[model samples]
Target: MRALRYYEEQGLLASARSGSGQRLYADTAVNRVRLIQQLYGAGLSSKTIAELLPCVDAKVSTPESRERLLVERDRINAQIAELILARDRLNDIIDATSKPNPTCDYV
Candidate 1:
């Protein structure tokens, strides 16, 4: 709920209020929130998400936005590569630690 409210405060989400002052979200809001989450997960800041949401809402992308998308994709790819390297190193350590030593009394 805090995230939803934060998104709203950041101009990334919208909601209507009921008579009792409860927030009402349209069905489309679900998809919007998911997109926002995906963008954030992909390493986009709230300001960047705000800038991109207009194009998303219009279902169109300008050349600048397309360029931005490419740049962000490249950044995500770099992060993924780093994560894979880290995971492989961790797996190697785990493999080394998990092997049984026949001469060890503790085994």
Candidate 2:
């Protein structure tokens, strides 16, 4: 809970405290934070993530916003997939380069 408060102060989360100082969050806030983390993990700029949040929260023009979010998700997914492929290729190269030379002619 204290960590959550810190996150709020950092603007990674948003909430309001009650009279007793218990924090209350907007229903969508956790989702927003998850989105922020996802974007960060995908190598997106915090500024870009900041800029996109409001439009996403607006939930306006139904189909338009939905499509936009889908596009973002797809872009992130593609980046992840490309990274995985690159990793596999790197492993293959490493394995091939590290193969033991069985020929004792050089010994």
Candidate 3:
């Protein structure tokens, strides 16, 4: 699929070309794709994901890589906090608007 090709182009995936020039994926490709999707869903950019993938593949984390992941985690936490505040503000507005106007004759 196009997404798979894009992932390949981004260096997040690999594929072998058949004699007919069609792409071939190993059995492990499924797991790799799933991990890529998970990282993306967690708000990682392609560049960040590419940097992290090598560490993940090696099953070893250098101090620098650990620091980078920690920074990303902090960013995600901050975003979650902001979204929660925005949701609360929206709820407050909804509660206020749902109240009847005491001076309205139509009421």
Candidate 4:
């Protein structure tokens, strides 16, 4: 609960309090926090995730909102492309290094 409160304060979660002062997290809030955790796990910084939240929460039925989500999807695709390229390059490097060193070997 403490951590949840801290997260709410950090603009990462939204919690509403009742007249009696009981903090209640909307059902959507639970999913939102989980989404944040997922994004964080994907290597995005907290600040970047925060910036992307508006688009994430936008209604998919709206054209503008749908476009925003598509934009973010494209960005993710680009990152995946770069990672793939880097992995291939790394594999090539390793393959080259693993080849027989023509002039150098111990007896």
- Residue 29's lDDT in candidate 3: 99
User: What is candidate 4's lDDT per residue for 1-107, written digit by digit as tens?
Assistant: 78677667767788778999999888887788778788777666667666667666663245654675567678889999999999999999888888678786744
Q: Would you list the clashing residue pairs of candidate 3?
A: none
By lDDT, rank the candidates, best first.
Answer: 3, 1, 4, 2
Error of 4 at 64 (Å): 1.4
Q: How well does each candidate superpose onto the true structure, as a TM-score?
A: 0.85, 0.53, 0.79, 0.56
lDDT agreement with native, every candidate = 0.94, 0.72, 0.94, 0.75
Give candidate 4's error at residue 36 in angstroms: 2.0
> Compared with the true structure, what per-residue lDDT tens digits does model 2 show for residues 1-107?
67566556556678887999888889987777777777777766666555566676675545655676678789988988998999999999879868677873554
Clashes of each: 0, 0, 0, 0
- Scored against the true structure, residue 43 in model 4 reaches a CA lDDT of 66
Model 2 stretches with alpha carbons more than 4 Å out: 1-12, 60-82, 94-107
TM-score ranking, best first: 1, 3, 4, 2
Residue lDDT tens for model 1, 1-107: 99999999999999999999999999999999999999999989999999989998999999999899889999999999999999999999889878777886863
- Candidate 3, residues 20-101: lDDT per residue as tens digits? 9999999999999999998899889999999999999999999999999999899989999999999999999879878787
- Deviation (Å) of 47 in candidate 4: 9.0
Q: Runs in model 4 with CA error above 4 Å? A: 1-7, 10-12, 16-30, 40-59, 99-107
